[model samples]
Target chain A: MEDTVEQPKAHGPHGYSARKDDHVKRLRRIEGQIRGLQRMVEQDEYCIDILTQVSASTKALQSFALSLLEEHLRHCVADAVEHGGPEADDKVAEATAAIARLLRS
Target chain B: MEDTVEQPKAHGPHGYSARKDDHVKRLRRIEGQIRGLQRMVEQDEYCIDILTQVSASTKALQSFALSLLEEHLRHCVADAVEHGGPEADDKVAEATAAIARLLRS
Candidate 1:
């Protein structure tokens, strides 16, 4: 087994562990951008203005996706492998295909 | 600074740490499924078969996404917040919007 670093146990009612404060923070900003986009569309903002923001949004999303992908590759997958079997292989495959689809989109 | 556990600084040319071996295994299975889908399409498999696979693929993708999302909420995002500032918030927001978009898809 690989070296294990015990993370702080975060208490929460959401089934999964408590999310990072930074994650929540990032989410809030994204929400603002989304709202801004909506306003732009409603106000008939310039195509360039809307598109520029859209592009920004897309890139931001891609970055976020990349970060999450990295973590999955490092943690959950690692844990699954350490534990063993065909199920792990199926899971990794499922994840990769999903990633390919995301990249395509 | 929070509790830091030094993970095996896996040696690799890949800028990021070496991915969990399990991730590769999952990816391989997903790849096989993709190939199977392609073959099925080439042979003009039944719509239901394709659709069923498509649905399965989508669910699989979503599951993968969820797993990644959980990790992000735990690690990178946690680190960012601990470090401090607006950049962290921005990143978290960016990630959140992307997730919302993904869930919608």
Candidate 2:
């Protein structure tokens, strides 16, 4: 099957756009896990057990963010750097801020 | 309104059991945030914007875990310590392990 990204009008397709389906699937699974945590809470599962699940959910989220960041650096940031302009610095700084947010969160 | 925890079978009501509704509400909101991320990906939203949202969701999950942990310390661990037995040490050890999991995750 063709892996060409279906471009959106607002801007060029993102690095992740090619693997959109895979990303969506990963997110949906994380969503399900969150819902399962809700069910466990409703059932009054042990507190430690619920905490374990919460940790797992958080890890899943961080993993997703890391994957997206990788693609952003490989495509968007790299493209900007290749052009050798002030925008390249801006892109690098912007990416750094995003990483800070992830770390703090 | 009566805040008396509705005890569950198999064991006494857990520390967070009294705030079960609150915990469930938080989980549901986090779940919604995850779905929102999926939509952002589907629509090809900027990766930075999506990353921001992911950080927010992760923060929310951590907040929920911290709240639950506070309650566990106030009730479950406190109760175990009051009894002054080997079980109290076990509870503290178990809680520490759970916290470690959260950190590593």
Best by lDDT: 2
Tens-place lDDT per residue, model 1, B1-86, is 11235533432322122444645566676777788889999999998999888777776666655655544544455444445477
What does candidate 2's lDDT look like per residue over B8-90, in tens digits? 52225778876888988988889889999999998989999999999999999999999999888888999899998999999
Model 2 per-residue lDDT tens digits across residues A1-103: 1244565522357877767888999999999999999988888788999999999999999999999999899888988888889999999999999999999
Model 2: iRMSD?
1.9
The local distance difference test score of each candidate is 0.59, 0.88
lDDT tens per residue, model 1, A4-66: 355434212221223446556766787888899999999999999999999888777776555
After superposing candidate 2, which stretches have Cα over 4 Å from the reference?
A1-12, B1-12
Clashes of 2: 0
Chain A TM-scores, all candidates?
0.74, 0.89
List candidate 1 stretches off by more than 4 Å: A1-105, B1-19
Clashing pairs in 2: none
